[model samples]
Target: MKMNTKGILFVYTMPLVLLHESYGFFVPGYPTKHISVSPQGKLLSTRSIPSTTTKPSLYSPSTSTSSLALKSSASSDDVQSITATNKLDSILSKLTSAFPFFVLGSAILGLMKPSSLQWTNQGTLISWMLASVMCATGLTLEKKDFTNVLAKDFAAVPAGVLCQFLIMPLTAWAIGRTFLLPLPDYGPSLFLGIALVGCSPGGTASNLVSLIAKADVALSVLLTSCSTILAAGVTPLLVKVLVGNAIHVSGWTLCEATARVILLPVLMGMIVNAKLPNLASKVSRFTPFASVVLVSLICGGVVSQNSSMFLSSKALLPLIVGSVMMLHCVGFAMGYFVPKVGLKFSEVTSRTISIETGMQNSALAVVLARSMGASPVASLPGALSATVHSCLGSILAGYWHSKNKKGKEESSESNKKDFTDRPEDDYPELLI
Candidate 1:
């Protein structure tokens, strides 16, 4: 038994001592009995190793050097991994923060390429995508949602409509006359964009903005659908009335083309959505991607169409300023005052109105420009507005999202306190 115990101690302690001692990791009082210094220099209590262990009469201080070398090697790998992970996280956050801006920039860059603007097979593809997006937008509707909106009997509903149709159109006209500085070749495009907004129904993105602001979602959905249906007729009429001469548009011609391109497709989508709800869902799922592709193609086409104009730095200021001012004023004003007139809307709904008014169906405007025989310069306002409104609108939506979250938290807390104060014995009575 004694011999076996000594053999076990020797087996365990000899390897540890040799491995650790070369690096000066010492197990104190160890020469007298079984003890071991681990690679990290901690004294480990081991039942497997016996007591009264053998030791060299002359022990060296450098016995644990190999262990130290191993630990040093492993630490370097851990450091490298942490550094790589930090860099990856930074890159991801930056990309996420800048995604909206990047999309806007890409649209602007596409405008410079003029080749991207030419009407070709690709233009038809964009048209089809626009059709699909309209269909997806239509899929979310039910007849009841509209009826519910009608039921509200709130003045804000009609007020919102009036602001969209009347107030905004006037605002556009005023902006174009005052700021854009009339030019025969390009001034008409600026006016056309404003007219497009004056005529366009609320866009699909308004529903998303309304959701973020915690506004009346059903009302927003109702208004958007109805307004879109109205837009088919209204857009052409308003464009003819306001900027018809600017583009030399024949009212009937513009109306017919508008009906074919914008109204017919939207009405068709709505009909399809009503009859084939399942197909609507499957297609609507791709609306985001579809919208992106369509916008890209349009912007690209516009760039290609106006490549020479784009190459001139002198024309850059008018294009940028005119587009920005038109979108900014129309969107910001309608958003601010429309809710305040006669009917009271929560801050959220107010924000939604602003976004909805500002973000027109620029795609429709671009298509209309093509039909009008207007230069690509005329479509520039619409293309640039598409980019600006999306970025600004997203920023505004994010602000409202934060506001809604705070309101929800407060409401939840109040509910919790209300429950806590109720009598323990009166739970059933409270339910009754």
Candidate 2:
């Protein structure tokens, strides 16, 4: 049921994603413009660049046919190569934008045929794949991004992280109890997996989602980076505190695993990005797409291995799905409302916080679940959480995008005398 419900969630979510992607991303209203300069040294918009209209003078000597032919062929080759590159990029963009659909399809396949992804269920394989995703995400960051968050003026960073760690752990526990997840003797409940997931850091995909939502992308990046770094210590402590009586969670073991699997690779990638930006830029383009693929595989592998759990009980699936989805929904609501209404943050920053808080690093949760020696079915919640939050995030982005647009329109109506038509001193605030 967890797998099937996730499939349904993705199926419903794809059209929303596609609708936004048509406007250039899993979002709308943010279009990029390309401009070029002519040989005569005039800047021109690509859409309106005029062709040469000057006629040749009668006295001019004729150029050689062979030289002219070679030049023409060379130019034609360059144009063809450029065209092919653009097409590849467009296709890749579409694939990444429609990522939830692909993950859903993979989940369906793995659930139907468990043996196909059975080989990928090993502990080492999960660890390596998760590490690679973390590394890929880190490659897109630089020293300045982390440093900016540490600046004294960035008060929201610490506050947001505090809320994430505090709110999510409690939320997960409450939701589990509400759903009546068994208390140990009933044969290895999902408490361990839910606890670990609740304790997870912000996902790497938060920044992308924030971008699509027109939120504060920089703030989201900082929150993800800070929470991930702190997870090495905080997650282990929280897990020990939450479900220590039922599950023997070794703080040292969990901490070591996190540092090795998550922190070290992230730092390594950051170093490379900082020291060798040229190489990082070229590699970063493909990292987002690769991370999406790795996430699908991890989710599929978990579902495939636990197919028996799904097959055994049709009734328990909804409980698991509802709990996981509710966890993220609570996280999003509290994360946003606390900052926006309670603390009086700007709309963009609040939206960013909400996304970063809600989108848990479920892949990390899946790895930790297996590493902790919980039941095979324990990883089910983490596997399905990814799909649930992605669907919710898309809906939020669309709603917020339309909201910001309407606000701008209303403001425009109010300020009919925009900039140039008004006195310079009277319109200073509207210049931008």
lDDT on C-alpha atoms for all candidate structures = 0.56, 0.72
Deviating ranges (above 4 Å) for candidate 2 = 1-25, 29-86, 148-153, 183-188, 407-432
For residue 224, give model 2's deviation from the true position in Å: 0.8
TM-score of each: 0.67, 0.80
- Per-residue C-alpha lDDT of model 1 across residues 189-271, encoded as one tens digit per residue: 66776566556656655565455445667777766776777777787788778776655766676676667655677677778
Candidate 2 lDDT, 117-236, residue by residue in tens: 787886489889999988886787777776776673387898789888999999997776556456433224577777778999678767767867878877888899889889988998
Q: In model 1, what lDDT does residue 138 have?
A: 61
- How high is the lDDT of residue 289 in model 1? 40
Alpha-carbon RMSD to native, per candidate = 23.4, 10.2
Q: What TM-score should be assigned to candidate 2?
A: 0.80
Output the TM-score of candidate 1: 0.67
